[model samples]
Target: MSLTKITDKAGLHRHLEAAMQLEHATIPPYLNALYSIKPGTNTEAFHILRAVAVEEMLHLTLAGNILNAVGGTPDMTVPGFVPLYPAYLPDGETDFQVDCQAFSRAAIETFLKIERPAQGATPGVDTIHKGRKRAHHNGHKRHGTALRARHVPGNEEEHFYSIGEFYQAIEEGLERLHAEMGDALFSGDPARQIGPEYYYSAGGGLMAVTDLASAKAAIRLISEQGEGVTDNIFDYEGEIAHYYRFEQLLLGRYYQKGDARGRPTGREVAVDWDAVFPIKANARIADFPEGSALRQGAEEFNRAYGDFLSLLTRAFQGEPALFVEAVGGMFQLKELYYQIMRQPLGDGTHAAPTYEIPHG
Candidate 1:
């Protein structure tokens, strides 16, 4: 795909808007899938997914930073953030599906679509591949050679590449988004740049940091913010809220008017905690009499997840600075949860697979 550059405000606006929203969109499912995994065993996949997920958080902040730099107000919590599986994308070039079906297969498909979207896939348009190299085999495409080949996964049905592929695609899309709209892309109200009220760090500040250098510094700060320093949406303001994206999958219920900041006795009142994941209680592997491998995996995940939560609570109870470490630890919970959820439903007889998001 041909790369589009942000030449005017409008172009900047559109690309960043789409980029920011999409970045936020990624965090929800990633959080759910990552958190649902049983902790610590599916080690390799865990690390990979965690890295991508965190970086995607970084991507969200980076997109927000860009919006700020361009005088755009970045809204973190917004509607349309939570999405369904095999989700549809606008301006999507390929037939590939983007979903919350959190698994290696889903992960791979997600990475592929985000990295190498079907935008600008015109004939004879050979773009150079510039990224870390892995062993290459398949199709007429040469190894180490970059071309806009159709990015179909090993599983033929999911036609996306990988996260890195999507990253590259975003770079290309930056240009396309710009060319298509020009100044209109970046032309949002500069007044929207986050101020003290909108910007919050667990213990400190995320006030508007204008200019590139300050922007990078602020990005580093918020990307590291989690739990103690500032509770994540998972444990917002000292509350255990939501059982899956504000209730889409959790009894189809929702929580509104969550308690305000510093009210930290229970889950943020804003999150709907009453909603339930039907399988969450009974689904624990330890709950089953048979004590199958799946049960063991589920139990192990629960233990680690509990520890992870404890760390966050303590981090907040003591020094918010503890949040940084909590970030990494909480990440482990996500990895573990994924492993736990991977147990196929009755030998793949399950209908409509789901990412084990414990939010509502």
Candidate 2:
């Protein structure tokens, strides 16, 4: 597939929304595995998954800041924004599948694919075009004269093979638009930006973007942390990226500095697969019987997830302080997920968070 060249502010904003959605997409599956681990067991794997999930949240905030820096509104509460489980990453890109499940070989493998590095030539193009007409999917029509790009199969000029490529295209767009629009490109209100004070407990602190340089740094942080720098598995912060961490679990060894690619020579790490609660893969609220404890627990978990999104939406809307409340919401989600895990489904399986938005 070909890359979609972004030329104007509108296209850049659309891609930023896509970026936000892509980052948000990784959290549910990660949380699914993280919460599924039995308490006091698989401690190392639990920490690893939790750390990665937190970084994904940071990536989401950075994408929102990038959108706001470019004078675009960040909306996370929109319908269909919170994807159904086993959904494709980045919404329109269907090259991979992500499933919500307990911590198992299959779940870790899915996480590995989600953070895999870009392999070939920056997956997309850098050419800019004006008035290019592209076909829309699902019988939907493009409402304006702005250039529309889709990532359907066989469309070489409108698809990206990996998340890194998608961000690279956004970076290129930012550069071009900054050259054209200069200071006006970062004209969004500074009050709307969420800074480090509001976000904590992550590997990297929040980056508030006000110009092209800061914006580029935020994008670099997200990309390198996930895909790594060039071919290396370590990010600039000297931490192993998500893919290598998951690989370490699979190889039964940790990745130490100066280790060769695909061969981790560090100390051994233990993963107790039996320690995970047997939560059904991609469990939904409807899967449980009505008025049952499992169903009620699943419903409550979904409600908390929805409230978290609501707070996040408000944070992106204008109230940056709402991020703190949203962080608290995240804590509530952890408790709720564990509560569900403690309740057995009576078939040798345990309850798990459905991750569906309540009333959505």
Best by TM-score: 2
lDDT (0 to 1) per candidate: 0.40, 0.78
Q: List model 1 lDDT by residue over 107-196, tens digit each.
A: 444543443312233123333333222213222222111112233233122112222233334344444655675544444344434344
| Model 2 Cα lDDT, one tens digit per residue, 1-360 | 123567778778888988887898888889889989988999999999988998999999999999998899898777657777777665234445688899999998888778866654223423222112223332432221122234434323445546776787899999999999898999899888999999877868788999999999999998888865365777667888878888899999998889976799999989999998899888878778999877887888877778788888899889999999889877777888889888777788877887777555
Candidate 1 at residue 236, lDDT?
30
User: What is the TM-score of candidate 1?
Assistant: 0.39
> Which stretches in model 1 have alpha-carbon errors above 4 Å?
1-11, 29-36, 89-94, 117-209, 212-360
Top lDDT: which candidate number?
Answer: 2
Worst 10 residues of 2 by lDDT: 140-149
Candidate 2 residues lying further than 4 Å off, grouped into runs, are 1-3, 121-157
Provide TM-scores for the models: 0.39, 0.88
